[model samples]
Target: MAFLEFTRLDERSVIEYVKSVAALSSILKLDDEGDAAEKLTVKEIGDGNLNFVFLVTNSVHSVIMKQSLPYIRCIGESWPLTKDRAYFEAMALEEQGRIAPHHVPQVYHFDPTMSLIAMRYLPPPHIILRKALIAGIQYPLLARHIAHFMANTLFFTSLLFHSTLDHKRQVAKFCGNAALCRHTEQVVFSDPYQISQYNHWTSPYLDPDAEALRHDNLLKLEIAILKSKFSEQAQALIHGDLHTSSVMVTPESTQVIDPEFAFYGPMGYDIGAFLGNLMLAFFAQDGLVDQPDHRKAYKEWILETIEDTWNLFYKNFVALWDEHRNGAGEAYLPAVYNNPEVQLLAQKRYMAELFHDSLGFGAAKMIRRIVGVAHVEDFESITDAAKRASCERKALNLAKMLLKDRAKFEGIAQIVSAIRQF
Candidate 1:
């Protein structure tokens, strides 16, 4: 019950806390073996902006404990954040894991009092997908697994599967996640556009480009439209921060983590976030193509993965919508779309809009990574400043185009083609 005091955990304190909690202590086999708790090893490995992540292991088992502080970890205590984000994270993971168990890590225990969650620790070789992409590694099943994850998670949480009454209840429950949602709205959709303290870039190189973004009236108009959807649309329960770093993968496994920012929002927001990060990875390849690390083929693979992910998601999502056309979903009544012709027409219209939404959101994600508060390691790892700037400019330009012209793009193939041209 000491955890009920709400003091932040240190190495010494975490061991004491674990010894006091049966759910965590049992996982380390402390009950079966008298000395198990004494043999446990714990190391803090949080590198993200928001939370403290510790990897705890005994001889036979390991678990990841994530604790949210009352402020942004990267920005320090001056920028306060709610530690209660852990509650929403635990809730989202449980719901999303039910829909896509294979793609999500199992949540073993969650401690709301301590603002902590203990989950399955992804073992070595299951690196973050962003790191894998940066290393020029190919995950053969990456596209298929991610597409399946997006389809199942998005469809099952949306109006396609939930009745109007149930959907509203779910939405109302998540609306309390307003703090994290506002963080996303400011960082992703707002900050990079105007002068803000958090915004930075490959400065002298992108000086004009960054200034141009501020003054571009047309671009601001488009961003305003996308921002409205991000704030207003409750189409589905989305993994709010679905960037590459949020995914852990190997040749065999792909696991999504960090739903602390999760809430009900536009489904395309999740899909676009993943695709956009992949595109950033592709752009950063040019900077990494030095010596034996020529990443031309890997760059091609990233593009292919991006194209395949969207294409497969489309196929699977539409299939789900068709299969459940007569279900409890209240989006399109069965009587209204009963005829084959109307059903086909509805499908086409729905898909077209989703595709455009995905493109626009994806483009915004890319732009933010390059010039916003948080920069991606894809470009950051490149030591040469000018070389890094070049890669970033290409990505930024491509993203701007996509944001403005996404409506013209009919499919993922066309988007892939534009990436190639850039």
Candidate 2:
């Protein structure tokens, strides 16, 4: 069929739209002779604030179709946003899948005009990792899988693996995604630090805490540096919103989704986002344990996962850098740093920078979630306001100290020990 004008598809219209496209029709196993709607079911499953997501399925197979709206769906037309984010998401998904196929969903279809993407549906038992964490479920393999995904994607995209020309070209491809980057800049980097209508907290309880963040000159200074890195450093192709909620998982399988915020930014942004959310879940565990059935063992799992993720990521990342030490990477030329001793020294310096970067970025991410426009379900699910505030305050204080003292930490173990302190 020819490209139709952009339409906001509903459950009913979505069926007709799918039937018109044969590939989508076949994905759902719809028979052409019968009414497509009779066999195909379209359920709106989008819980996020931006897109319209439909689970189009027959009894046999399913596909998730995501359509972008022209404005922010959560904030309405007053907060106008371009639908072009879907284009960047599609591009990012394709690149990320090429780099790490096992962790990313295959993009079966994308419609630039319609600002839509249809891809393999991640079915039941693959609930949002955040929800699983909130329920005290442990993904024993999460740290390993996430480490692989981040290491491969970030390494392959950076100058450590690509030529300067290729790296710049790849960066150019994603520069159009500046709008989403700007949104991240405002929410994660700027909004929480100042008085904004969008910013909120467990008020009265955190009223002083919220005010303190705005007035803290030292905190503001550190955030300025992180913000500069976010704005100016095109370290790698990062999954810009790589928090726990962006992941869907089971005990055995993990899949990363929703890269609409994807851009060429600091690699630490992705690492920090994931580790920071896990930290948030850890802090919220105290509030959650009030339930008779809740397990405190889950906190132990989170700590181990945090430690394992960074250690494994460090090991995997250094291994990649070593394997490609003689490759076309512009970051460290094998000829100039010809000796193994020098190579080892260079690797240490580089990894140290990345480690500190992740710490600062992670702290920034944690702080914003507590006081920014968006609040995580982990803290929000706590019924008591004072209890919720208590959890958030601990997380907030940890974040403040870490952001200021991120350079002092030499390894992930110290960070884990600090989480215990909080």
Candidate 3:
């Protein structure tokens, strides 16, 4: 078997390259002795910026083949991308699978040389939660599932699962990925908001009126949010980009995907990203919920999910801290070891940081969907401008409130109260 080198293959015949590059020829079962080893049927499926995702199906099974190109495919010659990104993504996904096996796709094979990944194909009934929200659908268990997912995945992957030295080693390895994270900080946060000729909004969704408003005001706010998020540097390994589109789901299941941007960064970035998208969905409920009662019910679910997610995350995080108490020594607490008041004070400080970050990132995420180039699917399908605008306004109001008073805001109760004002 040939050991693949990801950069050698040209993009012209990607499918043939994928088949030859992966371990499929030897590891995947292709029977009947002479059937010409069934070629992978591939088609593009996502609107992501950094990679090319194909739905690959063979006779026996279905899978997704995700390729990380040196530069974004859509941008073509305008910008050059580093093929090394494929290497980082493969590593990130593999680690995430280990951390949250049930909530992520199974990595069938990774061809670092070819810059491609082969993974289990989850089905359609499981759409991106953002798209589902656009259709006005609700997943009653989303908050619980996501909260657990965040708590378990983030906590264990950091200080809890490994010794301080071990965790530091992991964080250091990922920190080498600074280039990719810098790009994200620029593209998703910085560049999108800058007042420049290069940035412009489009169509029934991004009209001149909205574009000017975003350029004049919204961009500054988003940029500030991005700067603060990047500055926090709690420097733990993070998914880096966690939003509705990054997640796949059905009524009973939720799966998060696309960790190509994975790197060590502020912990709040991940939490804020997920919560921000959920808040966006809540505001867009006007277009999503068909019946009045259903709207109210779904709204409650969103709020409950927010509160429940925070609570569940706190509980699980504390459980991890208890198990790793010896390792957590001095980095976070005094030597008292069992003082209730000391523990409570530490808990208050940690939750306070979480609350602040969540609020800031949440605000940034909601506003960017309206003003940035990469919009959310929650309101993409809504044809009514008046209704959509109203929903967006509500989301914007929540974002403003959160950003202005994130540090002062205490719990889910206060955050929900602020969101309700919108």
Error of 3 at 329 (Å): 6.5
Q: Model 2, 318-365: lDDT tens per residue?
A: 999988888999988877999989988998998899999998999999
Model 1 TM-score on a 0 to 1 scale: 0.98
Q: Report the lDDT tens digits of candidate 3 across residue range 1-422.
A: 24345553333344565456435543434443654355546677757766777775556566677777677665665667776787777788888888778888988787766777888789979887777766667787777777777876777666545666777778777766767777666655665455543343334544654544445564466457657667556446678789888888898898988887787676777888888888888887777655546688777777777788777777877887776766643445346636877877876787678768767776766666775656666776666777777677677656766766677876778887777777
Model 3 misplacement above 4 A? 1-15, 18-22, 31-36, 74-76, 160-162, 198-232, 288-294, 327-330, 333-338
> lDDT (CA) for every model shown?
0.91, 0.90, 0.70
Model 3: lDDT of residue 261:
77
Error of model 3, residue 339, in angstroms: 2.1
Top lDDT model: 1
Query: What tens digits encode model 1's per-residue C-alpha lDDT throughout 31-68?
Result: 78467877888899987779999888888699898999
Q: Cα miss at 75, model 1 (Å)? A: 1.2
**Clashing pairs counted in every model:** 0, 0, 5
Q: What clash count does candidate 1 reach?
A: 0
TM-score of every candidate:
0.98, 0.97, 0.86
Candidate 1 lDDT at 141 equals: 96
